[model samples]
Structures are given as C-alpha cells and as structure tokens.
Target: MSKSIELKKKAAEIRIRLMQMIHKAKAGHTGGSLSNTDILTVLYYHTMRHNPMEPKWNERDRFIASKGHSVESLWCILADLGYFPSSELDTFSQFGTRLIGHPNNKVDGIEMNTGALGHGLPISVGMALAAKRYDNDYRVFCLMGDGEQAEGSVWEAAMAGSHYKLDNLVGIIDRNGLQISGSTEDVMGLDPLDKKWEAFGWHVVSIDGNDIDALIETFDKVPSVEGKPTLIIANTVKGKGVSFAENAINWHHRVPSEEELALAVQELQAQIESLDSKEEPCHE
Candidate 1:
C-alpha cells in the first residue's frame, strides 16, 4: 500500500480506538484527541525514528506531547505500536493506571511528564540543545495546542530555539481553535500566530493538519530552512472524523454518549473500509 493511504487507514483505526477508550473510561479530552490523531499517526508511523522495543534508545527521535490533556490518541498510538500492552488501555483513567489523563514519564515512550501548557516547547528546546551539546543527532518533536500559544513561556522557548539554532527541533501546533473552556480566540487571541513564531526567528509552515497526505509531505521536509527551528501550524478541526463532534466546542472534554459512540464507530469504520478499498487492485 502507498504510504499516505496506509497512514490514513491507521489514523482512522486509531481514532476508533481512542473514541472507544474515552467512551469506555467515561473520561477524556475527546475533541482535541480526534483533531490531532492524524498528526500523531504521521509522526509515530511515518516520520519519527524510534523502536517500540527500545523506547529509551539513545539515538531514537523524541516526541513531547505539549497539549497533554488530549493524550487518548497518543496512548492508543503507543500501545498500537507495541510500546506497551494494548490491553492496558482498559485501565485508562482508572485508579492507579499509568495511563492517566495526561502523559506520565513512567510510560516507556514518554520523554517528559506534561499536561500543563507551555512547558513542552521549553523542555523540547533543552532536548534539542542537549543534542547539539553532546553531539547527538536525534531530533525532538513537540506537539502543542493552539490555545497554549497564549502562554508567554512558549515564546521564550521559541527565542531560545532560534538563538541556539536548533534546527533538529520541530514544534507543531494542533490549531483546532477550541480549548477546554471555549474557542482560543474567545479566551486569548492568537491570530497572526505563525507570524509571531517567525518573528521569534523560527521557520513556520502552515497546512491542513487533518490531511494525511499533507501531514506526510510536510513532516518529510522538516527544517526546510537550515539554522532555524521549524514550526508547523497544523490547521485542524476539533472533533474531526465524527459527524456530530467536528469543530464543536462542547466536545472538547465531553465523552461521547453510548449512542454517540456507536455512531462515531460506524463513521470511522466506514472510513477504514474506504481506505482499504483504495489499496485493492482495480478489476478491468
């Protein structure tokens, strides 16, 4: 199968899995998880270099989930990739489960514990700078929420990334527009966000975050400009894939109802089947 098509199928499956996880646990940041699924899919499956068998391998690329509340997708992806047992998903959000609402560093694949906004980029900058200092070549990829852009610390890290010329670092904003309370603009205006990053001395690129093909292509051309950190403003829809939840603010932390879960599964399953059909040979 073609790479992009495979990624599309995988992302649909992950979405279904995340939705099921959230629905079963009766808690999750549903909308953001759905929005960032494609980005995570492309990174874990296609872009980043790492081994499930060696989650802490010295040479492996690092991924930091800055917008950690929407961790259902990352958890499902990590398990699906064999970083941990898929069965553990059942314990998500349960008492004493390693899989909590936010990422835990105790998890094999997680680099840093994150849930608080604005910390990811700074930590990622440290990692990238460490790579330079120690002469390690592994890149650091940090995924941040657009709402998190309001945090002043993000710009501090942005300046440090550029000042240090950490081209090995890549920052992606899941620009889905909604936060836990409401739209990001309603709470904090971040228009001209890309420009702000550019002003901070990073190279910025904007693309449709939900498009599998676009994600693949964009990630493949990382550090498109030498000597600067790369920032990808991934424009995405909150609650993508599910008909009822797409772009709906209430779905941000809202767990799907039993009925809503059923419908979402049906829709995502259809997407899986559609992508699967494209892989079959045409019969003349």
Candidate 2:
C-alpha cells in the first residue's frame, strides 16, 4: 500500500519474527525487545544510512543497542536487512552460536560489543566525536533503556556529548517505564527526564515510540540544534504489541509460553490486517 503503511507492516513482521526467535530459544529479554522494535525498525529501514552488504563502510552511519539485553529485536532487524542469513535467528542465545544474548562486533551489522548496560552512549559519543575530528558526515545513534539511565556513566557521557557538541550523535531512551524489577520510577526515579537531559545541555524531544510515523518524523528532524547532541525520549509500553505481555514487568526477561505466543500471534496478525485495511493506532 502506502509508504507509511508499509513501515507499519514491516514493524509487525519484525515483532512476529523476534517473538518466534525468542520463543524457539525459550529465552530473551522479551519486554524490552518488543518495546524497542519499532525504533529499530525505523532506524534500519528508514532513518539510518546503513548497508547490509557493506556494514563497515566508513561513510555508513553507526548504531549501538546499549540496552543490549534487548538484542533479539536488533538481530531481527539486521537479519531481515540481509546482514546475515535469517536462518541464523534460530540459533539465537544458543551456545556455539554467534547470535549471543548480547551484541558483539563479530556480527556483521553490530558496531561493537554492548550488553553491559549504560555503555552505548559513551561508545557512540566516541564514534561521533571521531567523525567530527576526521571531518566525516556519518552519524551515530544509540538506543538505551530508562533503567540504564540510573548509571552514573550515562550522565558522564551525556555531559561529554554536550561539551563536545556532538550534533551527529542521536540517542534514544526507550522510556518503557517498566524494567526487569519493576517500574523505573519505583526503582530509581527519572522524573522530569527531558529536563534532566536539557540541563545536561542536550536537545531533547519526546514522542510516542511505538508509532512508526512519529518515529520516522522524529528521526528525520533530529539534530534540530546546532552543536548539540539530540536525545529522543521515546515514550513506549514495555512488551508493546503483545496483549498479555504489554506493561507486564514479569515479561521483562520472561519467555512466552506456547499459549502466550499464540495470543501474541493472533494480536499481531490482527494489527497487520487492520493496517492493510486503512490505518489504526498501534497498540502501545
């Protein structure tokens, strides 16, 4: 159908595939994977200038999944883009498989190893700063979790991004609220999140992260300020797209039971069909 509709369909397909991948393996950081899917979909399919065939091309943009536990979603995107064979998804999280729980540079599309939360932004900052030093135009993007924001290293990197004026770096916080333990606010409050980043000298924008159209528009208009890093506070529902899993903290790292998988499949199929009919708000 239309371009926007196509993006929605792509996201649905990725969600379906990633859930299956996790289900087959009987393990994954489920809630965060689903919550972060739409953002990864938009980045790989639309926003980022990356090549599956030449993942390491210097001119290509860089992306890091700092909240590395959610890598099932990223792997789905990379495989669909042909960075590697889709069959490899089946081996995810298995011993002797390259598709480990966390992303490592060994994977074709991965920019670096990242699973120790709160490191993505710092690494991305270094990449973006190096781009500036070399007078290159490549940009760097990092996706993180709200829980990871509690790390002091994140703030240190945030201050550095601002001080260095990394206009080419864009970081997105998957503000899904719920983390593995419980609600992020309950764990460690990050209220006034936007202002906190702004106080650190960032250009912050908040938006519905599940909406593909909103995601597209936001990414297109980033680096809105000159000489500043952009941090998108993406409001998202933990376990987005799965009826039973959505906002359920227990699903943070839980594997879906067969019944739960069937329900998720039914719900996502309905979503895909509805998009085909016209347009509807994606369930958050």
Candidate 3:
C-alpha cells in the first residue's frame, strides 16, 4: 500500500481504538487522545525509529507522551505498531489491565508511566542526554499538551535541553487550545507559545496537528537547529475527527455513549473513504 494510504488506515484504526477503549473502560481522556491521534500516528507509524518486537531497544527512538491523560491514544498506536497484540487493547482501563488510564513502562512499548502534567519533557531530556553521552543515534520525542505548559517543569526542562545542547530531543506540543476547563487562552493564556520556547533557547515550529502531510514534513525536519532541542507547536483541536466532540471541552474526560461511539466510527470511516479517493496509485 502507498504510504499515504497506510497512514490514513493507521489513523482510522487509532480513532476506532481510542473510542472503543474509552467506551469499554467507561473512563478515559477522550478529547485529548482524539485530538492528538494524528500526531501520534505520524510518529509511531512513519517517523520514529523503534523495534516493536524488542520494545527495550536502546538504539530505538523514544516517545514520551507528556500529557499522559492521552495514554489511550498512545496505547492504540503502540498496539497498531505490533508492540502488543491489538486484542490487548480491549483490556484498556479494566481491572489489572496494563493498558491503564495513563501509560506505564511495564507495558511492552511504554517508555514511562506518566499522567501528571509537565513530566515527560524532563524525562525525555534525560533520555536524550543519555543517548548523547553513550554516542547513540536514538532520538527522544516528547509530546506535551498546550495546557501542560502551565507547569514550571516544562520550562525548566526546556532550559536544560538547550543548556545541554540536546538537539537529539524533539518536543511536539499538542496545542489544542482547550484543557479540562475552558479555552487555554481563558484558563492561562499560552499565547506567544512559540516565542516562549524560542526565548528558552530552543528552536520552534508550528503546524496543523491533524494534517498528515504537515506532520510528516515537520517531524522530518526535527532537531531544527544544531545545538538546540526542536519543538513543534502543533495546533490541534480537542476531540478532533469526531464532529460532536471536536473542540468540545466536556469530552476531555468524557466517556462516549453507545450512540456516540457509533457516530465516531462512522466519521472515521468517512475519513478513510476520503483518503482512499484522493490517494494516487503507488508506482513502485
């Protein structure tokens, strides 16, 4: 299959998994997970270097989901990438299931157990530092929520990354503009977000989070500068892909009802159809 078609399929499968897991678990951060699905898809399926069979490969690229509430999205991607059987996804959030509400390193492909905001970057910096010290080619990719930037640790990590000259670190911010409360601007404006990172001595770029082409291009251009960490301020919408939940704050941790799940699946199918129609035949 063409790369575009494969990516589109992966995105659809991820959306389905997100909705199914949340619905089955009867608990999850639906909005945030859905919002960043495309970004995660791009990384796990197309960009990041990692071994699915050997989840602990030292030379593999590391992905830290800084906004841990979106663990369901990460889990879905990991499963799709064969880190674990897709069947395991059904156990999400259930009692004793490894697929908890937040990521846990014990899981086959999870690099860390994160749920608390603003934690992933620091860990990613450490990982990048280690890779550099060991002279490894691995890259650390950290994904953070826009609201999570409210945490002081993020800035601290940002400074540390630049100070250490950890260009091997790449941070992708899910700038969906809404947290659990209201708009991020209304809650605690992170406007001039790009400038904030730049001021911290990191390189910054912004893109539409849901656009696959833009996502691929931006990630391919990572480590934006020679001596600084790269941050992609991905502009996204909460509850992306699903019409009713798109940008709806209520869906932040809301569980989709049976009816809602049907709608979400239908919407994803439509997206797949749209992509299929536009896909050019792969010559090779």
Per-model TM-score, in order, reads 0.99, 0.97, 0.96
Best by TM-score: 1
Encode model 1's per-residue lDDT on 1-284: one tens digit a residue. Answer: 99888899899999999999999899999999999999999999999999999888999999999999999999999999998999999999999999999999999999989999999999999999999999999999999999999899998999999999999999999999988888899999998998889999989999999999999899999867889999999999999999899989899899898999999999999998998888899989
Candidate 2's C-alpha runs over 4 A off are 279-284
What would you estimate as the lDDT of candidate 1?
0.94
Report the error of model 1 at residue 93, Å.
0.2
Worst lDDT window (10 residues) for model 3? 1-10
- Least well predicted 10-residue stretch by lDDT in candidate 2: 275-284
Q: For each candidate, C-alpha RMSD in Å?
A: 0.8, 3.4, 2.0
Count of backbone clashes, every candidate in sequence: 0, 0, 0
Q: For residues 1-284, could you state the per-residue lDDT of candidate 2 as single tens digits?
A: 67778988888899999889999999899999999999998898898898888888999999999999999989998999899999999999888999999997899999899989888999999999999999999999999999999999999999999999999999999999997788899999999999999999999999999988899999998667999999999999999999888898899989888888888988999999998878554678
Model 1 residue runs over 4 Å out of place are none
TM-score of candidate 1 to 2 decimals: 0.99
lDDT of 2: 0.92
Q: Check candidate 2 and list the clashing pairs.
A: none
lDDT of 3 by residue, 163-214 (tens): 9999999999999999888899999999898998999988899899988888
